[model samples]
Each structure stands twice: as C-alpha cells, then as structure tokens.
Target: MKKLFILFIFLLVCNLQSYSQIIFENGYFINENNQKINCLIENQDWKNNPTGFNYKLDGNQNILAADIKTIKEFGVNGQSKFVRALVKIDRSTTKIETMSREKNPEFNDEKLFLKVLIEGNATLYLYDDGNLRSFFYKNNDSEIKQLVYKMYLVGNYSIAKNNYFREQLFIDFKCETISQKEYENLAYEKKALEKFFIKYNKCNDPNFVSNETKKKKDLFNLTIRPRLNSTSFSTNNSMSDTFDIKFDSNTNVSLGVETEFIFSFNKNKWSIIVEPTYQYYKTEKTKESSVYLGGEVIGKVDYKSIELPIGLRHYFFLNDGFKIFANASFVFDFSSQSKIKFTRNDGSEANSLDIKSGTGFGIGAGCKLKDKYSLEFRYLTGRNLLSNYVTWKSSFATASLILGYSFF
Candidate 1:
C-alpha cells in the first residue's frame, strides 16, 4: 500500500507538467506592432485569467510565450477572447474573516488581460485571479472601467455588500427594453451579467450575435468495469494462539458498473464516481492442531459480497484520445450467509463463525483511451471481517487490475 501511494504521487506530478502540451488550438494574437498573427495557442481552459500565454507559429516545432506587455489581444477562434487593458481594479479581500470596514472599494491602476464574455453594444469583461473576480465594461469610444462591487464587514460582526454595479449599469446602459427590477436583481456573476449584456445588445440590434463562447455540456458517463483481484485473508484469535490461521492468496474475478459525473469547470478534468462490484472467495486448508494430541484441524472459508466504492477522480489529458487519472475511494461491503468453519480430523464439525461485512479504502491510477477503454492498478487497504467479534480479528487486502469500457 505504501509503495502504491508513492507511485501515485510520482505519476500525479509528472502528468501535471505534461498536460499543457495536449490542447493547442487555432488562435490569433495581436502583437505590440499591431500585427495579427494566426497561430496555435495552448488553451488551458483557464480557471483564472492568465498574464501570459503559449503559442506556436505555423509549421513551427518550437513553442513560444507572450505576456500582457507584448500581446494586445488574443482569441481562440470562436471559443474565447482576451484583451489587454489598463483599468482601476479593487484588490480587497472578500473573505468575511479579513474583510475591511470601509464600504467603498480600494481601487488601484493595473494592466491585465480581461476575458471577453460578451462583445456588442455594451461589452462585458472579466478579470479573475482565482481568489478575486472583477468585472469591467466599455461602450462606444469610452475607456474601459471596472464595475463597482464589494463585500465588507459591518460592525465587525455582519457582512454587507455594496451593489453599486447595478446603479452603474442603470445609468450607463439606458435601454428601453431593460427594466429597473432586472438591474436591481442582477448578480455580480459571470452568467447573469453575460445574459444581461446579451439582452441589451439584442434590444439595440435584433441581428446582433453574442460572441460569448458557451462551455460544452457533456458531463456524465457510465462505464462497465471488470477486474482480476489478487486477494489475501488472515485471521487470529487474540486470546488463544491455537485457533490462529492464515489462508493462501487467491486470484478472483469481479464485475462492476460505474457512474461518473464530470464537473463543468476546470476544463472538465475532475469527476465524482460511484461503482458497485461483486466478488467472492472460497478456500480450504488443513493443519495439525497445536494443543489437541493426535488430532488435525481443517479450516474452510466461503465469502461473497457486493462492494460499493465512492470516489473522486482527476484527469490529465494527453490529447483528445488519451488521458491519465488518479482516484481515491471509500469502500463498503455487504455480505450475508458467509462463514468460516473448522472441523476435526474425523470429519466432525468443531466450530463455525459467521463472517460479517466491513469497510475499507482504495487508491488507484489509470489511463483512458478514446473515451472508451481504460486500464487501472488499484490497491485496497486491509479490512477486518471479524470486527463484530471481540476476540477474533481478520485482515483482508486486495490488489486489482481493472479494465473499463464506457458505454457513453
């Protein structure tokens, strides 16, 4: 288990460094010279606005990088766009624990790459640094301006929001079709602001086309998984050494069905998974008794259970066809009518113990191909099936080679 965990960490680090190479898409960048060069830009599906970007020229093998200082604008075809701008931004923390007492925003002038969410009569832009998200806008020939919105502490006990952005919107964007109630209810979020901007643009010109790039919505999948598990079990009586026994390891097959829900954010690189699996083990052994004279002990075990594992998975795309992922799972098993029995050398029964269900944990790493097939190496921690017994304890561990085929 320790070795498996170390390997998972090593693979995770390596995959993070290499994932950036798989997503170069057709895009164009405007340099300081005002020259628009068509090239392939690496799209990280950035969670936050980036200060620099990587690109490769046509027929070139070497990758290049450009920063906000050199690039005036860049766009990944129809997917997304960013423009360099000098604007007044608030750097105040919105966290309740460290909020300021001032109601007004503390603004500073900074140069940034603002993401274009809607580009029309009234354009909406977003600047996010993972912790803070600030919106900016510009109309006609006016200079770009930040929307005023802040959260601050009130009386050191309660929080207050300054919704000055709604007032700013009502004054700047005087539209006959937009109502004051809509402005008052507008949220300082990406989707709501983008929708409002689109509505305003459409009202002015019915033929207006929103340049907003909507993210893909395929976020669910189901898979069939089959595995070969190398399982081992051992048990002992803590009060008596004569009843202790160890079973030989066995290789068994298991089948499972998995449901995965991929998150819409972070480039669809993370997901939650639930898998239900069925497995069984049956074995028998004989050994001489330590305490009984001229007698032998024969032990037999029969166990069957359905296991449910719920986990989180993170993927690193090598390309559209291939990706690597790592996951951790908490497992719960259910079993009935499973037992271990011991008999005397004369074929008479001595004792029988009912086996109970247990809980365990697992860690795995794997790669998927073409969104259909996958292979994984998984290790499960030891579980004590005799946990219901006070004096008897058991250890069951498994290492598995799992194969997966996605149906959708």
Candidate 2:
C-alpha cells in the first residue's frame, strides 16, 4: 500500500507538469499589412475573449505574442475565429446595487477582438470579459457595431431592461418570414442570438454558411467501477483498556456505478462526479484477557455498508486517447445489520456493539484510456463507526485500487 501510494504521488506530479505546457494548434493570423500568416497558435479554449495570443511560425521553436493592437484577425481552423474591430460598447454595471437609473445605455469606444458567432450576410459577434457580456453585429458592407442592451434600477426595489437590441435587429435584419412577435420574444443571450442570426441569414440567402462552433451534446457519462479494497478497523472503550483491539487488515472486492457530468467550457477539462459503492470489512482477533484471569477473548467485526462519494474531477489531456485525472470526494456511509462482537473462549457472548454510519473524505488520482478504461488509486480517511455511542469509539480506513469501464 505504501509503495502504491508513492507511485501515485510520482505520477501525479509528472502529469501536473505536463498540463502546464502550452497547447498550440493550427491557426492563422492576419497582420496590419493585410498579409495572412499561417502558424501554430496557443489554444486555451478560452471562456472569455482573449486580448492577445501566443504563436509560433512553422518549424520554429521560438514563440511570439500578439494582441489586438498588432493582429487584425486570428482563428483556430474550424474551431473559433476572432476579428479586431473598433466599436461602441456599453460598460454599464448590471448589478442591482450599482445599476444606473437611466434607461438608455452609455456607450464607450473601444477596440476589441470580437468572437464571430455567425458569418454570412448578417454576422453576429460576442465579447465577454468574465464579468460582462456584450454582443456585436454587422451586415454586408457595413461597419460593425454593438447591439445595445442594458439593465437599470427602477424605483427602489424594481428593475427593468433596455431591450434596444431587439429593435435594432428588427430594423436592420428584418425578413419577410420573421414576425414582430419573434423579435419581441428573442432573448439577449449567446445561443438565442446565434440561432436567430443563423435563421435570418439562411432566410435571406439559402447558400449562407454557418460558421458558429457547435457545442457538444454529450455532457454526461456513466461508468462501472470494480475495486479491490484494503481496509483496517480498530476500536477502544473509554472506561476500559480490555476493549481495545486492532484487527488485521483485510482485502475485499466491491462495485460502484459512477455518474459524471462534464462542464462545457475549458476544453471539457472539468467535471462533477457521484459514485455509489458497496463495501464490507470483516476480521477477527484473539487476545489473552487481563481481567478474565487467564481466559481468552475473541473479537470480531462484521461490517457492511453502502458508500456515496460526491466530488469534483479535473482532467489533463495527454492526447486524443489518453488523459490523467485527479479528484477529491466527501463520503457518506450507510450500514445495516453490522456490529462488533466480543465473546469468551467458552463460546458465550461477552459484549456486542451495534455499528453506526460515518462520514469521511477521499482523494484519488487516475488515468483513462480511450475514454473507456480507467485505473485509480484512492485513500479514504478514517471514519468513526461508533459515532452513535458516547463512550465507545472506532476508526475504519480503506485504500482502494479501482478499475473502471465507461458505458458512455
């Protein structure tokens, strides 16, 4: 167990360092001279709009950085695209505590790299800086501009929205097939706006090309895990030393079904996991009694429980088929018909204590192959099985070697 733990720590450090390296993908950047240069650009799978990027020329080991000031445009082929545009943007605070009472938006002139969501006759763009989200648009042969939307405080407790973006869309991109009711119901969000722009563009020109990045639909997964558990248990009575006993560590097999939910952003590197497992521990020890006058006592534990571990996981992608992951979980255990029994050498029961449920924590590191097979090393902290008793105490710890197969 100690050797396996050390090996897990060594692999964890190596994988963490590997995750620190930049991931460069095939992309192109247009310079101020209107010349397009194909190169390898660092792809962070950015959740917010990036101000600058790092790139390397073909066959060059040295990397270079560029921002909106020098680069006119840049794109990771078939993944995402951005263009530098000088436009009017609203920098208003939408928080209710600090919202401006005025209904109209206060616009500021800024240069930003707008992410293209739709790219036909009528194009839609987005600028997000983690805290604020602003959308932009432009038609063929027209200057790009911000779609105005704002939130304001109404009396002391009321709030309202300035939905001027809807009116702007009605006036500029109105089509015979789109009705006024559609415009009124359209939400000021990325997916809603992107869908609306795509529909309008295709309505106007049947040959319109949709350039938006399609998000993945499979965000949840189910996995079956079978584990070999090395478990140890000990108990002591507060008033007597004869009740203290350390049972030998025992090994057992258990099964778990894991449900995982993957987040959409950050290249799908983060996830939430919930695993329900069944585990058991049984061991016996014979000790010479000090108080029983040369008589022997037999101590036995027959413990069985269902363990639920809910946790967060992070993945470091090594390639398309391999990845390493780490996770931490809080475990809640439930046991039924479980107890610790103490008996005399003559086969008469001396004492019996009912086992109670407990809570503990666990940490694990693992590697996955082809998104289907996985192996993990996990250690759970000591849990008190005598929690229901004030005078009796017990500690139970487990180390697991788990094998997983994903059905997803």
Candidate 3:
C-alpha cells in the first residue's frame, strides 16, 4: 500500500509539470516608452493581480517577463484589463497587530497593477494580493487615487474603523437629488464599488452604457469513481484466553461513484462531496496455540458492506489545468453479512460469529487534472466490528486508492 501511494504521488508531480506550459492569448501591452505592443501574452488566469507578466512577440518561442514598473497597461481580449500606476497605499495594522502597543497606520507610495473593474466616466480599479485589498478610482483620465481607510485600537481594548472613503466619495461625486443614504450604504467591496461607479456614470450621461459582461454561474459535477482497497484487522479475545491475534492485510478492487457541488466563491476552489461504495473481504488462516498444549486451530472471516461518506474539499491551483486538493469526511458503514468461523484440534464443530455495523472517518489528499479527472489516496480507521460478539472485539482499518472522472 505504501509503495502504491508513493507511485501515485510521483505520477502527480509529472502531470503537474506537464500542465505548466505557457498558454498564449490575443492581447497587447504598453511598454515603458508609452508604445502599444501588439503581441500574444501568456495567460495564467490569475486569481490575484500579478506583479509581473510574460509575453511573446509574433507567436515566437522566445518569452519575456515584465514588471509593474516596466508596463503602463495590458489587457486580454474580452477578458480583463490592468493599468500600472503609483498610488498611496494604506499601511494600517490589522486588529491582531494593533495589540502590540502601536496603533498608527503607515502610508507609502508604490506602483502596482490594478485590475480595471468599471471603465466609464468614473473608472473603478482594484488591487488585491491575498493579504490586503485596496480600491482606486479616477475621473475622466485624471490621476488615480486610493480610497482612505484605517484601523486603530480604542478604549477598553476595542478597535475602531475609520472610513474616510465614504466621506471622499460623497464630497467628490454628490450631485443633484442624490440622497445621503446612498453614500452611507456604500461598502468597501467589489460589487458595491462597481455599482456606485455605474450609478455615477449614468447620472452624468443618460445614454451611458456599461462595457462589463455577466460572470459565469456556479458549477455542479457528478463523477464515477473506481478504487482499490486494502484492509487489516486485529483483536485480543479475553473470553477464549487467547493472546493478540493479527490477521494479514488483504487487498481488493471495488467500484464506487460520487457527486460534487462546487460553491461559487474564491474561483470555485471549495466543494462539498458525497459518495456511496461497496466492499467485500474474505480471508482464512491456520494457527498453533501456545496456551492450549499441542493444539491447532483454523480461523476464517468474511465481510460484505456498503458505505456512505459525506465531506468537504478545498483546491489549490498549481497552474491553469492542474490543482492539488485535501479533504476530510465521516462515513457510515452497513455490514450486510459478516461471519467469523473457528475450529479447534479436539475434532470439535466450527463456531460462527456475526459482525455488526460501524462508523469511521477518513483524511486524504490528491491531484486533479483539468478539473475533470483526479487520483486520490486515503486512510480510514474506526469502530470495532465485533463489539456484539462475546469472545472478541476487533477493530477494522483500510487504505484506499481512488481514480475518478467527472461527467458533468
């Protein structure tokens, strides 16, 4: 089982490297000298605004990288646009950082690639780097400015939020018949910012039309999974006065199916999953007992079960077509038929015991290819199957390797 798991990991690494090739798309970039260069840009489909980009000239193999300071603007055709400019950034400490006796925010000027959110009379831009998020705006090609905000420690160990952005917006863009309630309800998020800018544009010109398109909706996926399973059992029977009895691990192949419902958040990186599976095990062994003088015994066990597991999974994208994921789940197992048979050396009849239902949990990690196929390895340990038997209480454990393909 360990060898198989290692092999799976090796294959996943190879797949990841193979999927990392650059994907060129129709785009253009403005160089430092304010010249628009029509070329093919390598699109990584980044979730966060990248500090640098790669481009090729005239579909050639040679690739070049450019930083924020070297590029004035860039855009993918019908996808997105970004502009590089120097803007004042808020260096305010977070709530946790404010507990260290310093409560003032530091301000500095830096150049960054801000994503163009709404591009009309009042353009709205955004800069996000996974840790800090800041919004910028410009009016009729004027200089860009960052909306001001700060967090500071207050009395009684509390924190106060200073929202200067609200005041600035109301003072700069307030027009005839625009209510104060509209400014008060403005939030510091992408949707709210976009809506406010759109309203401003429409107020200035009744014929103003938006250039933004509707985003794609959330996705639902159903998959068929087939797995290879390995199992081991251990027990000590006090009623039979026997020492530890260890059974050799057994391996089997099984088929199962699962469905995934992906949430429409954070670039579709989160999901909920449920799977139903079937398993069977059969093993037999002969043993010599030291407790019983010159005695011999024969033991056999058989198991047939159905399992249902429900869980949550999160994905980390390595590139455009490959990602790594981790998941955890709780399982309910129903043993349809289980039997344990034993025979002793005194020419005695075989005794049979029936096993009961159980529950367990599993943790696993895997890699996905193109959001359609995946390979996973997991370990499961749980409740005793022989709890109802008088002579023994046995624990069951299993490790499984699963391969899955998404149909929808």
Q: Which residue ranges in model 2 land beyond 4 Å of their true spot?
A: 10-15, 19-21, 93-95, 214-218, 293-296, 348-350
lDDT of each: 0.86, 0.88, 0.77
Of the two candidates 2 and 3, the one with more favorable lDDT, higher being better, is: 2
lDDT of 2 by residue, 1-408 (tens): 634664775578567756744679999999999999999998877789999999999999899999999999999988899999999888888887788998988888888999988898999999998789999999887999889899998887598999999999999998988888999999999989998998999899988879866655457889999999888788888987788888888889999999999987778888999999998788899888867644788899998999999999988888878888888899999998999999888888889989997899988888899889999888888899999999899989888999999999
Model 3: colliding residue pairs:
none
Number of clashing residue pairs, candidate 3: 0
Candidate whose lDDT is highest: 2
TM-score of each: 0.85, 0.91, 0.71
lDDT of 3: 0.77
List residue ranges in candidate 3 displaced over 4 A: 1-9, 99-106, 175-178, 206-228, 232-286, 293-408
Worst 10 residues of 2 by lDDT: 1-10
Question: In what order do the candidates fall by lDDT, top score first?
Answer: 2, 1, 3
Clashing pairs in 2: none
Clashes of each: 0, 0, 0
